[model samples]
Target chain A: MKLHTYFRSSASYRVRIALQLKGLPYEYLPVHLVRGEHKAPAYASHVGDALVPSLETDDGHWLTQSMAIMEYLDETHAAHPLLPADALGRAHVRALAQMVACEIHPLNNLRVLKYLVHELKVSDEAKTGWYAHWARSGLEAFERQLALLDAERKAGGLPPSVFCWGDVPGMAECCLVPQVFNAQRFAVNLDGLPRLMEVVERCNAMPAFQSAHPSACPDAQ
Target chain B: MKLHTYFRSSASYRVRIALQLKGLPYEYLPVHLVRGEHKAPAYASHVGDALVPSLETDDGHWLTQSMAIMEYLDETHAAHPLLPADALGRAHVRALAQMVACEIHPLNNLRVLKYLVHELKVSDEAKTGWYAHWARSGLEAFERQLALLDAERKAGGLPPSVFCWGDVPGMAECCLVPQVFNAQRFAVNLDGLPRLMEVVERCNAMPAFQSAHPSACPDAQ
Candidate 1:
């Protein structure tokens, strides 16, 4: 397997963590996002979408979209599953993931940021403000969700655990760490998110999460 | 089950179609997006993310994110499955879905549109151009994928199918309809996508799809 990835892409980072967690050995084919490599004719011909973290399977099947690619990997190699076994639990995990993937991350992506500066002619300060606004607002909602889960557990509605769903750090944690990282980058306050912060700290200590950090990758500045 | 939805929200429309297709009866608790009812204290108290299309089950479980909600409904009510039984097929369907959900829809969403107009102060013409650009580019990619599938079938690589996968629309068509609707709204060209257009036409002919349309909803202008 080979992954077309940009080191600093949060979506790519999520896939890397999933690969590491599953103990999958794959070649990393770096596509430098900063250099417009993702939009290059050669790479775009294969993926068609011109998006990074496109995984080419051993059988020559190319997969795009970080969440889709991650789910594909989880389904194909189920040793350490990223989703829970049951239906409701899986839904909760996915909802947590999408809260970041769809609602937050897309708004703050490199392309969108570039559009703000180049196309919209927004000042750097305004662009950064936009980034921080989303980071703070999105993460606050996530923090509330975590609190709700805890409260539900206290009221015997959900099971008590260290992770988002239960014992293991599944898709939710995979998404959470990246958003938290982005939050820290934007200097968003983490004051009322102790539980979320604790989970991030725990996940970051793991080798899978540690190895997937943007700064640890070869392509990072 | 009850769905907390904004009628014009593409995400909400996806889930509404899924529910209708599955023959499930769901009460629509309309949250007016234009009036900012989604952010009302009452609604926001229940929803952690303050996003629409929150599905509340008889069991009192609230499901957020249209994709996650659709998957949950598919899992619990197995009469009409929204995803393929096999992992590879599921991956293919999901990748197609995310091509719209993650890539196209996010860029043209209400918030993004508002950002373009209010924050960036882009002229209506330029904003329309931006919308058309993403819609056209995204549909072009979708058309290419469909064409690739057609070629594969001719070469005996894949079986002939009425829908994106086989038989049912699955994840791909769920996303495709709204996108095509938006594309047409922006007057994006549809010359090269006969297969996609055919699929869209077939889907629109269905009662479920028709009833779930933006115009059929209570909040439609």
Candidate 2:
């Protein structure tokens, strides 16, 4: 298998962590986002969107989108499943993942940010402020969700579990670590989010996550 | 079952189609997004996020996130399944869905657009441009993916199918209609996307899609 990835891309980071967690080996082919290699025809043909982290299976099937790739890995490999067996539990895990992947990260992507400055002529201060605004608000909502999950468990609404679903850390943790990383980088307040912070710390301690760190990748500066 | 929804919300619209496709009876409990009813404690408590289109199941479960809700419906009530049976096919369908749901729609959501103007102080023209930018780029990518799928079928790489996955439209078309609605609203070009446009037209011809349209709802103005 081969993964076309950018070292600093959060979505690619997600795929890397999933691959490592599943103990899957793949050749890393760097597609430099900063250098605009993704926009070239050869790369774009493999991924219709010209996005990084396109995974090509040994059978030559190319898959795009981080969450989709993660789900595929979980389904095909099944060693370290990224979703719970139960329907509701799977829904909860997916909701947590989408809260970050769908709601938060898209607005803060490199292309979107660049568009804000170059096309919309947003000032530097305002741009950073914009970043912090979305980050803080989204994280606050995420914290609320985590609190609700814990509260549900306390109230006996959910079964006792160490992770988001049962004992396994599925898509929720996959998404949480990166958003938390970005939040810390942007200096967003992490106060009053003990449960969320605890999960982040636990996830960060894993070798899979450690290896998937953007800085640890060969393409990172 | 009850669905807390605002008729004009794309997320809610997707759920509406899914429910209709499955022939499930659901009470519509309108949560007026413009009136900030989603933020009210009663509604916010039900859903950790102040997002709309939360499904309250007959078993008293509250499901949030449109995609998650759709997946749950697909799992628990599988008469008219929305995902392909095969893992690879499911991944492709989901990738197409997220290409719209995560990539395009989130950036152009009501709150995000409001933030663009009020918080970032972007001009109305620039804000509209921002909306069009994402829609255009996202649709262009979608077209590319569809083209590849079509090309594969033409070359006998994959089976020829009526829909994104097979006979049923699946998540791809669930996401596609709202995006096309947004694209038309933004006046983005649809000139190069014959396959997608054909699919859109076919989907609109179905009662599920027609009934779930924003303008077809009681709250539409």
Candidate 3:
């Protein structure tokens, strides 16, 4: 297996965590997005979308979309599952994941940030403000989501844990870690988001999550 | 099941089609996004994320995120499955679906558009340009993705079909229709993309897609 990755790409970082969690060994083929290497003909021919984190499976199937890639790994590997066994639990985890993947990261990706500075010509203050806007609101909503889950668990007389769902770090953590990394990078004031911050801290302590951090990546500057 | 929906929301439209396709009868509880009903105190209390297209399941669980909700419906009500049976096929379907759901819809949604126009004070022309920019490139990538699939299937001696993955109109179609609608609404020229438009047209011909359209909704103003 091979993964096309960029060290600082949150989406790529997500796939790395999933690979580590599943214990799937893959050769990391770095595609430097900052150098426009992703758009280069060599890389573009392999992954038509020109996106980082396209995983080429052992059977030689190339997959794009980080969430889809993560799910694929889980389905194939099956040792440590990313999603829960039951339907409803899977929905719960997926919803938490999408709250970050869809609502948060899409707005703050490198291309969108570049657009704000280049095409829109927004001030440095406003550019960072946009990042802070999505990060703060997204983290707040995420914290509230955890609170809602905690409330449900309390009502059901279940004990709380460090992970987002049940006793494991799964899909939500794959999403949560990178997002919190971005949040801190932009100095988003996550002061009141204790639950969210706690989950990030817990996931960061785990070897799978720790090894996938941007600073630990081979391409990290 | 009862769906909290905004008529013109692409995300909402995706779930509406999923419900209709599965033959699930649900009361359409309209949330007027234009009127800020999704962010209303009442709605926020029920759905912590305060997003539309949340499905209150038969067991009274509120599901947010259209992709998550659709997957839940697929898992619980298995009369008609949205994803492919095999692991690789499921991954393919999900990747196609996420290509649109994650990449295109998030950028052009109401709140982001509002932020671009109201907060950033971008010109009306630039706002529309932003919409077309993501839509055009996204749709083009989608078409290329389908083309990539076609190439693979051809190599495997598999026959072609109208939908993204196979013979059925499933997850990808659910996402594709809404995105094409948005593209056309924003006046993006989709002429060169034949394969994508054909799928959209085929999906439109189906009663499920037709009934879930924005105009069919009670609050479509």
Candidate 4:
């Protein structure tokens, strides 16, 4: 398998962490989003929209979108399953993952940031404000979710683990690592989100997440 | 079962259509997003983030995110399965679904639009421009995906159907209808997307899609 990725791309970071967690090795092919390498025809053919972190399977089929690609990897590999064994648990994990993917990260991604500066002609200060607004609000919601989950577990007399679900890191970890990285980059206030930041620290300490960090990627400048 | 939803929410519309497709009866409880009813303590207690289209199961679990809620419904009530049985096919269906859910819909949702105008103080012309830019670019990518799928099917000597996956409408259809409705409302110029529009037309002719449309909601006015 091969993955087309970019060093600073959050979505690309998500797929890398998932691959690492599953103990799956794939050739890393960098798609330079900053340099417009993704717009090349060869890459565009592989990923219809020229999105990064597209996985080309051994059988030659390509998959796009980090969540969908992660799900595909989980389905085909199935060793260290990213989702839970049961239906309800899977829904909870998915909901947590989407909170990061859909609500927070999408609004503050590279393209949207660039759009604020260039297309909308917003000043850098205001651009940063926009970033912090979405990031902080989204993380507040995430913090609430973690609190709710912990309360439920405590109510059932179950001990809490460092990971989002049980003792194993899964889809939510894949999402949280990249998001926390982005949050710190823009200096989004992390003071109110102690629980979420703790999970982020736990995830980053793992060898899998350490290896998948953007600084460790071949395309890191 | 009860669904917390708003009349014009694209995400809410997706789950409603899924429930209709599965032939399940669910009581609709309107959460007026514009009126800030989602932030009410009771509603917020049920959904941590106060997002709409939250499904309360008969067993008392509240599921959030349209995709996750739909998956839960599909898992618990399995008469009309939304995803394909095979892993690869399921991956394809999910990729298409996320193209709408993750890419297009997030940028144009009511909150984001409100942010663009109220917070950024963007001129109406530029705000509309921002909306069109993201919506059109995302849809173009989606159209390219459909074309690729069609080419692959033809190469495999498989016949094409009116729906995204096959003869039946499923998750992708749930996402596509709402997106197309919003596109037409914004005058995003759907002329270039004949294949997607054709699928949209076919889906709208179905009772499930028709009944789940925004106009059919009790608080649609």
Candidate 5:
């Protein structure tokens, strides 16, 4: 297997964490987004969305989108599952993951930031401001979700989750770690998201997550 | 089941299509985004994200995020599966869905547009241009993905997909149709993407999609 990744891309960071969590070894193929390698014709032709973090499966299929790729990994390699076994639990975990994937990451990705500057003609300060705003607000929502989940668990006679959903740092943790990395990179004020930040602390202490951090990636400058 | 939705929201529309496809009965509970009903104290307290298209299940849990809710419905109901049975096929379908859900829809939603106008002080024309730009480029990506899938299918000795994946309008179609609806509403250029537009046309011809259209919603303005 091969992963087409950019070290600094939070999306790529997500797939990296998933791969590490599954104890799967794959060649890391870097696509340098900052240098516009992702836009090169060969890469663009190969990847429809021309995005980083596309996993090339053993059968030679290139899977795009971090969420889909992560789910694919979880399904094929069931040990150390990224999602829970039950339907409702899966829903809860997936919603937490999407809170980061769909809400926070999309707004602050490279192309969107470039659009604000080169296309929309926003200032650099404004671009950073946009990044922080989405990150802060989205994490607030995530914290609120954790609280809701805690209350639900108490009602169901289950203990509170040590990670996003449970003690294991599953799917939601995979997503939250990367987004928090990006947030800290941009100096986003992550002041109010205690439960989410707590999960990040627990995830960061794990070797899988520590090794998957962008600084540890081969392409990291 | 009850769905908290706003008629014009593409995300809400995705869930509605899934429910209708599964033949599941759900009461429509409207959350008017334009008038700011989603941000109300009561609604916000009930829903962590305070976003529409949340499903209040039979046991009274509020499930959020269209993708998660749709998958939960598929898992629990199992009669009309929104995803393909095989893992790889499911990845293909989900990648298609996220191309809209993650890439396109998030950037052009109501809040993002409001940020562009009120926060960034962009003119209305720029905001519309922003909408059309992401919509058009994102559809181009969708079309490219379909072509790639076609090639992969041929390699696997399978027939060309009639809908997004196969003859059935499953999860990808559930997402694609509403996105196309919003694209058309914003008058985004649909000239180049024949495959995607074809899927939209076929989906529109179905009773499930027809009844789920925003115009068919109780809160359609």
Candidate 6:
């Protein structure tokens, strides 16, 4: 497998973490998003969205979208399952994942920031503010969901979840770790989200997550 | 099942279509997003993000995030499968769905637009421009993916996909139809996306999509 990735992209970082967790080996193909490499014909014509973290499978299928790609990896390589076995458990984990994927990262990605600065002509201060607002609010939601899940677990006579859902760090961690990384990078307020921050700390301690960090990437500046 | 939804929310509309497709009988509980009902304690205290289109399952579990909720419904009911049976096919379908879900819808949602206007003070004209730009560009990407999938189908000696994957309108259509609904509402230029529009027309002809239309909702103005 070959992953087309950008070092600092949260989506790319997500796929990298998934690959590491599953102990899958893949060549890292870096696309310089800031340099307009993703828009060039070489990359754009082949990939449908011309987006980073597109996984070129061993069988030559090119898959885009981090959530879809990570799910695909889990389905195909079932050694380290990313989702839970039951339906409702899967739903809980996925909702936590989407809180970052859909609600937060989409608003703070490089392109959206570029649009705000260039098209809307917003100042640097406003740009950072926009990024921080979404990250902080989205993390707050994540923490609340964690609390709800914890209460549910207690009610069910199950122990508190060591990770996002259970004792294991699965799909939700793959998303949350990268998002918290972005939050810290932008200096987003992370004071009150203790549950989310604890999950982040647990994930960062894992070898897989540490291996997948942007700083460890070959293209990291 | 009871769905907490707003008529015009694309995410809510997506779940409505999914429920209709599955033949699931769900009570529609409308949450007026524009009126700030979603943020009220009655809704916010129960829901993780207090977002619309939350599915309160028969067992009384509140499922949030349209993608996760739809998948949960598909898994529990299993009567009308939203995803393909095979792994790769599921990935392809999911990536197509995320093209709209994760990429397009997030940027143009009510909250983001409100932030642009109230917080950043962007003019109405610029706000509309921002909406059109993301919608048009995102649709262009969706069109490109459909084309790529079509070619892949032909190469594999299979018939061309009639409705985003096969003859049936599945998960991808559930997401695409609502997004196109929003695109039309915003008057985003839909000139170049023939394949996407064709799917939209086909989906509109179906009873499920018709029943899920925003105008059919009791709360729609």
- Tens-digit lDDT string for candidate 4 (B44-90): 97676789889888877788889988888888887889887877777
Query: For all the models shown, what interface RMSD does each have?
Result: 1.5, 0.9, 1.0, 1.0, 0.6, 0.8
lDDT for each residue of candidate 5 in B12-90, tens digit (9 for 90 to 100): 9999999999999989999999899999986888778888879999898889999999999999998789998999999
Per-residue lDDT over B1-221 for candidate 3, one digit per residue giving the tens place of the 0 to 100 score: 88999899899999999989999999999998878888888888767679888988777777889999999999889877899898878888898898898888889988999999888999999998889888889888888888988887777778886688789988999999999998888889898899989899999999999999999999888
DockQ of 4: 0.78
User: Candidate 1: which docking quality band?
Assistant: medium
Docking class of 5: high
lDDT of 1 at A83: 96
3 or 5: which has the higher lDDT? 5
DockQ score for model 2:
0.82
Worst 10 residues of 2 chain A by lDDT: A156-165
Question: Residue A92's C-alpha lDDT in candidate 4?
Answer: 82
| Local error of candidate 1 at residue A73 (angstroms) | 1.6
Best by DockQ: 5
Candidate 1 error regions (>4 Å): A186-189, B152-156
Candidate 1 backbone collisions, by pair: none
Please tell me which model should have the higher TM-score, number 3 or number 6: 6
| All candidates: DockQ | 0.68, 0.82, 0.77, 0.78, 0.87, 0.85
**Error of model 2, residue A26, in angstroms:** 1.5
**Estimated TM-score for each candidate:** 0.94, 0.97, 0.98, 0.98, 0.99, 0.99
Instruction: State the TM-score for model 3.
Output: 0.98
Stretches of candidate 6 off by over 4 Å are: none
Q: Give the clashing residue pairs of candidate 3, or none.
A: none
Native contacts recovered by candidate 3, as a share? Answer: 0.65
Model 5 spans > 4 angstroms off: none
Of 1 and 5, which scores higher on lDDT? 5
Q: On residues A95-188, what C-alpha lDDT tens digit does candidate 6 reach at each position?
A: 9999999999989999999999999999999999999999988989999989988888888788889999998998899999999999898888
Candidate 1's C-alpha lDDT? 0.84
Answer with 4 or 6, whichever has the higher lDDT. Answer: 6
